[model samples]
Target chain A: MIQLIAYLIIIVLTIIFLIKMIPRKLKKSPPYTCGEPMKFEKPETVFYRTLSNILGLKKLQKLSTGNLNDYLLMIFICFMLLLIVLVMV
Target chain B: MLAPYAVPLLICTAFALPVFKNEKLIKAIAILAIFLSLSFVLSSSIEVFNSGTKVFAVSGFKAPFGIVMVLDKFSSTVASLILFLSLMIAAFSSKLVKERVKEFYTLLLLGIVGSLGIVITGDIFNMFVFTEIMNIATYALIGFTAKKEGLEASFKYLIIGSVSAVLMLLAISLLYSHVGTLNMADIISRIDTNDIYLKTIFIMLILSFCVKIAVFPFYVWKPDVISGSLEPVAAFFIGVMTTTTVYVIIRIFYTILGIYYSTWFSIIAIVTMIVGSFLALLQKDIKRILAYGSISQLGYIFLAFSTGLAFQGMYHLVNNAIIEVLLFLSIGTMLMHKKMMEKISMYAFLLGALSLIGIPPLSAFFSKFFIITGLLEKNLFIYAIISGLISIVTLLYYMKIYFMLKQGEKKIYWPIIILIIAVLLLSFVPVWLQIFKGVEVDLLARNEYVSEVLRP
Candidate 1:
């Protein structure tokens, strides 16, 4: 359907634009060693990374004024859809 | 000829999206069109309410021959709710929406126009078209910002919405095959819907509508979309759109489906409330909390409708519209503050949360009482218990929020407005019993409402 094609085109183009624009807005730096970009030539494994001392798992859990509103809102709205499914049943 | 003006007007305005290059002219036109559309809604709804039903043959075609726009008590009731709230929302937008004003207002009008069309049209195919219109507007509004969270919420909504729309279209297609027509009344009355596929279509519609209303399970998208938006926009939909969609569900289920046969609906209503309340308790985000709160509140709509108390159901619906407007508006107002905004909003949030949990004298408490009593009167014991337990859970979570906010020194006069809601719903009970003739009997519902939506 034409509508389906339009939807695909719009979504694809938007995603492409987002990928290009967002990274351009950020400063490029050699990625940090902990989060270093894995080379395509050599495959990376979780066990390998742990043994290689590349990533610090505990470092990710920094103390901050956590804002959970956005995530919680998503769950709440999804619940609405579930309610609808129940109603339809 | 005149029957389709609402949808046509919206389409025309939307078509100009490429022309105006901005939404200003279209915004002005939208306001004018709504005022014009309100007249039609008022006139036709009034006629239907008084005479029972009014049928307009679209372009002079009759029944099976051509599209018919029928105005029944249910249709008119919802039309009044949608238009009057829309008018108020438009007025609210004068202050609320400033950035991207043209596009925002156009989308707002488009959504309203779609809902209006859905309420007024008697054709199933027409309903599908309007659903698309309404759904598109919501998607645009939710995705108005490209923030990561905003886009994520919209993406989630887009996926669920696509599924529901597909199911709805399939159901409509199936109905068309069976009846060889898309007119609602004709299909219901002429065809033997006892077929298994009839059940399938019913399930599909109920699924679609539940998503629209943001009831339990399907409600996950509402908190994100509503709370994730900028404050004023959140207020607009939180205050109006979600409630309007619930009204849409009521109309579609009871009137369109003519589903007076089963208590299965009551069961679903109970589930939405229980799940909603439990979820609300676990939420940390103020908006997500409110979103869950709304889902729990809608539980009452289902409870009342299943009890076969139509007036009671309508009463709860109207009460919610008022409460949400006040609560969200206060939130919007508090957010407008500079230094004390964070603290003040926390307090306002408490007021809203407390009211939602049925704190005494809050509109929610009294309205909730009416629902419980009404259900008990109908001997729906299990439903009343489930609904009441959910209320208790609501009370617990709301109290928690209230204490948390009270811990802060900076406070606004949130109680002054909170008390206002209590008094309003309290007055409704006396007014309903005719114990107080303070206002005209006709305005018993409208007077309690702070919003300018006059059903008459």
Candidate 2:
């Protein structure tokens, strides 16, 4: 319990220090945009879109279009693949 | 004695809740019942850890003939954890849920009862019954908001969940036909591990539960369900519901079937981790991101279990539950108050996200550490490296949420405060309680569980 308390104290102190020391202006700046105002897309959108394109996961994501029939087909295909793999092993 | 009463007490309370028209009274009854149930589970778990396994046969019928509830170190701990999460969610929901208060509490109580039954019961057929009960309650709860999206998500889940239930029942029937018994211990003692028919049965069972836990190819419906439901209900699904399903998988594969490792399951786990993390990166909705995040976390737990690290798997399971619930409830509170742009909520969200990313000195960090070490010990260097990479991916997505957060009014939510404290205190569980040693033993020692259940 003493060790736990010590760890907790360290964590609390670290968080407080970081919060106090960081400049408020820096902390509040909108990420990935210049100081000048312009139309800005969400950083996550840009990052993930590039990553997905690089990885070619766009096709996979398209397959998961929230359509019930597509979901059922995916389930069937996956189950069959798993069944075959396990049975062979 | 008190252990057997926990499920029954909740059932009785659920049935009695509809009689009270007053919402406040109904909420009080529901919370009190869960609190009392949690107490019973805690007392029982303490006794179980000290004295070994305890079995309670229904109506004095012996095991292998009638239903029995086994409170080993593993089940008791899981039951206690489930009840504790339920209690916290119930309390949090007291103010969040507005429509059909009686029905909401009733379904919640029933869901708790089903989750408890799944963990505690020793009969395979009884487990199927409990799974249905749990799934039905969840179906209703998901649609409780009565919105178009919520209704559609609930309907889709109902179709998928019912199909899985049918597969589970069929698997149970096949096992019964092969072994001529429904008791887990009895089947373990009498069955052959290398038989082709038995292997098929095991696969069917695994696939059904894989859907429930939202593994790789089966996880598509989960984000919709989480995004459509109320925040507290979504938290329940992520924290209690999925955790209990994982427990069922562990119990069946490790304790009953006596299969310690599987290559295929490891492959599935790795794919699940990659898919869930990458998908989460693309999501803009907070709940959708969390939904995929949880799927990624479950993959880590599955990887541990499949690699024969039951202790690490169970440790990560507990950590994942606490961290996910903390995130869901805190975010839920922010949405409820229309304070999504608050700095306090952002801080709370960061705490959970960092923990999920396996930052040092946090509870998940230790579990992830144990899992990677265990993987290395088994000479699974490739799996270890993939797990590490997934952590980086986890951090990237969570950082996306961090940067998206904006500053506004800072208001405190008591449930979020309590949960944040819980997440912090979880780091001490392994050192302070020292119960994981006993749970590991209980998981690995198949004969001990078998003998205890079958003892006259």
Candidate 3:
């Protein structure tokens, strides 16, 4: 049962990542843009501004081409570790 | 006798090659070492095929407790092919490297040693050690040119490959903890299929090797590595490097694990095929196109495995090695000159491309036919159909490259002519003889493999 659940979770996460990545790949987003369209403007949201602050302007541009999702990545990693521990235990 | 000498001879020569300052002598020794190794493996392969499995008990120790080498039909066949291909690549590219010739040839020979070790080793831990050796050599080889793209590609491959290696080591540790054995045959004898621990270990090992073989999610580094490396180096990577990884996969899942993860392998194979062919279709650069095409060809090998066609899969594996080496070498020659390809080179490329498409009369067709037939016999119509359809996609991309080729009147090189002749001979062999018919009997006899290793 646990194996099935683990497999399903991986499949779901992979599907979600693929959903997010296909568009960026199709558009061939430039580096540091995270798949988001570039425009001349200050940060529109606190999320964007704080992220840009942390990563710097250049990396923010690369990340915005929309490849990285910090929250999901953390969740996925945690889930994998949990699965490994569960299997081992 | 030759089985025991091949690896040591290659390793000694590899280390010795870099000690010499004479470029011409270094080149000669490198070629001579590879050619000699090729002959050694060839003689050993014939002996093994004619008689039975040959075991080389290392340092007066037998299997289970000692490091042993088993030259069965499978290992001998693949190892011989790899050594032969290494010799060809070495001879073909001897003059291509203008700088660091010694380091280049040294790493090349060492890499071949690693690959040969992986195929012949009976212990799981020895296999991992060899995997690392091969990977490290490859990492250096890819970055040898010191070009920006080569370094980036090498770095990327290193990151992914190191993680996979760690995973494999962990899997080995887990298996040892449970079975108290590092010998693959002994582990198989002790494995408990019902235990979740064993199941997890199985999954871990499969995933690790899957990464090595670049199945789906783990394939991100493949295109970059192939495109970034020098053409002959890329040929070596594509042709023999990937073949050894798949060999390990087969040895583990089919031989040691005794567990069939056919569904997962099938899913991975189908996805890899689709993604590879589609990406190949989209590429404009010649190397990138061939890289993606090679990825697609890997998918076909796994697809055969998924259908329980181990022999047929190996047949495809052999075919892919020959065809990819031919295609990469020919295209590489053309690209090196930056001129229109000679008519013979074009014909060679066409032969490779057509063979890859599974055109009848080519040796590749028989392998694919057998795989599809096996699938159909098992009522796996969907898989059979999917694989069949994927061949068309394979042909389409190959045709795109075919049309892109610029015809020239220059003469093809002698080495390339030899490769073309090799392909032709391989293609015609299946027509007149049932030489490979024994592979099925050899591969599926699990009990035979176990007894051969355990025998005093």
Contacts from the true interface found in each model, as a fraction, amount to: 0.05, 0.47, 0.05
B62-132: candidate 2 lDDT, tens digit per residue: 99898898989899988888888888889889868888888898888888888899998999999999888
Candidate 3, superposed: residue stretches over 4 Å from native:
A1-89, B1-19, B429-433
Let me know the DockQ for model 3: 0.04
State each model's TM-score restricted to chain B. 0.80, 0.96, 0.95
**Reference-based TM-score, model 2:** 0.91
Residue B327 displacement (Å), model 3: 1.0
lDDT of 3 at B305: 77
> TM-score, each model?
0.70, 0.91, 0.82
**Model 2 chain B: which ten-residue window has the lowest total lDDT?**
B1-10
- For candidate 1, give the DockQ: 0.03
Residue A78 displacement (Å), model 2: 1.5
lDDT of 1 by residue, B1-456 (tens): 154355535544765556765545655666666667777778876665455456667787766567766665555656766666565556545555657776677777778767777766768788888878877887777777666776766676676677678767887888788668776666655555456667666666666667666665456566767666655456556555666566556655554455543566677678778766666555556566666777777878877766665656666676666566555555554444531334544544565566666777665676677778877877777777777778777776565444333232354443324434443644456554332122112222222221211112
lDDT of 3 by residue, B25-141 (tens): 877878888777778888877888799998878897888788889888878878888887887788777746768887888788878878888988988899998888889889999
Better of 1 and 2 by lDDT: 2
What is the Cα-based lDDT of residue B287 in candidate 3?
Answer: 86
Query: What does the lDDT come to for candidate 2?
Result: 0.85
